[model samples]
Target: MNEMLLAAFALFVAYLYLPTAWLSGLRPAKPMTRQANHLHCPENKFYIPEDAVLRRHFVSQLRWEIEAALHPRPTDSILQRHYDALVTIKLEQRLADMGCLKPC
Candidate 1:
């Protein structure tokens, strides 16, 4: 029957979309905390592409670019920049903890 088909389609759509919607807003809604400030990436005063972890050109800039893309927020540039910096810092810390980061 038409009703049965419509119900089945609705259930299929829910099954596919619900998980994505649930996971989309995983970031905290509140403003950044003091602890979060500590997690931000330090300013790069001196950078050398050859000494980078992957030896890629403009490695730090590339990282920031990727982080900015992956964790985009509907916020001002300053807040978004800070969020990306924190993401990079956390990524570096995780790599260091795992012993996967070679000294550069």
Candidate 2:
């Protein structure tokens, strides 16, 4: 019953936000260019540049701040922590793949 109520509320919220978000001129990002490929790894298929990932995470944090201002949540938090954790794991894996016990 709680799950069903949550699902219905989530769907209603999405329906309300979809048109507002569309009207707010928020659109999907454009494709990255060939010259700007260092930010991503096509071979392994993930974001590669630590700086870019951090920058994106920072921007998202700011977005969450704005959202929190509009609608004050009891616990206002962004997913940057999770993003950083994943990035750390990915960086360690890449280092391991390159035969380094520790990053130089």
Give lDDT for model 2.
Answer: 0.54
Which regions of candidate 2 are displaced past 4 Å?
A: 1-78, 100-104
RMSD value for candidate 2: 16.2
Candidate 2 lDDT over 16-78, as tens digits, reads 877766745776676876645554333443332347677578446545554454423334245
Q: What are the models' TM-scores?
A: 0.29, 0.24
Give the top-scoring candidate (lDDT): 1
TM-score of 1: 0.29
Model 2, TM vs. native: 0.24
Reference-based lDDT, residue 67, model 2 = 48
Score each candidate by Cα lDDT. Answer: 0.59, 0.54
Clashes of each: 0, 0
Which residue pairs clash in candidate 1?
none
| Model 1: number of backbone collisions | 0
The residue-level lDDT of candidate 1 at 104 comes to 23
